[model samples]
Target: MKTYVCPACGLVYDEAAGLPEHGIPAGTPWADVPESWRCPECNIGKTDFVPMEL
Candidate 1:
């Protein structure tokens, strides 16, 4: 699975280790994440996230 990084705060969202704290279960894919879900670290929208290089 791929990972994403928040541009504002460098928060890393790993697809294999979903954000359970935000109700996103483990192994959840990026496309499955709600559009309204913001970065927990910086509160930035999903558009602010970029694909991180593995």
Candidate 2:
């Protein structure tokens, strides 16, 4: 699975290890994650997340 990172705080979102505690389950693709979702570390919106290289 691919990964994404928040540009502002470096919080990562791995598609294979979804944040289940926050309502996202394992295997959830980045495309499925809601746009309203925010980084737990810095509270940055998903719009600011970028695909992580490798």
TM-score of each: 0.94, 0.88
Which candidate's TM-score is highest? Answer: 1
Candidate 1, TM-score vs. the true structure? 0.94
Q: What would the per-residue lDDT of candidate 1 be over residues 1-54, giving only the tens digit for each residue?
A: 999999899999999999999899999999999999999887999988999998
Backbone clashes in model 1, listed as residue pairs: none
lDDT of 2 by residue, 1-54 (tens): 999998998888999999998899999999999988899989998988999998
RMSD of each: 0.6, 0.9
Instruction: Identify the runs in model 1 with alpha carbons over 4 angstroms from their true place.
Output: none
Cα lDDT, all candidates: 0.94, 0.92
* Candidate with maximal lDDT: 1
> C-alpha displacement of 48 in model 1, angstroms?
1.1
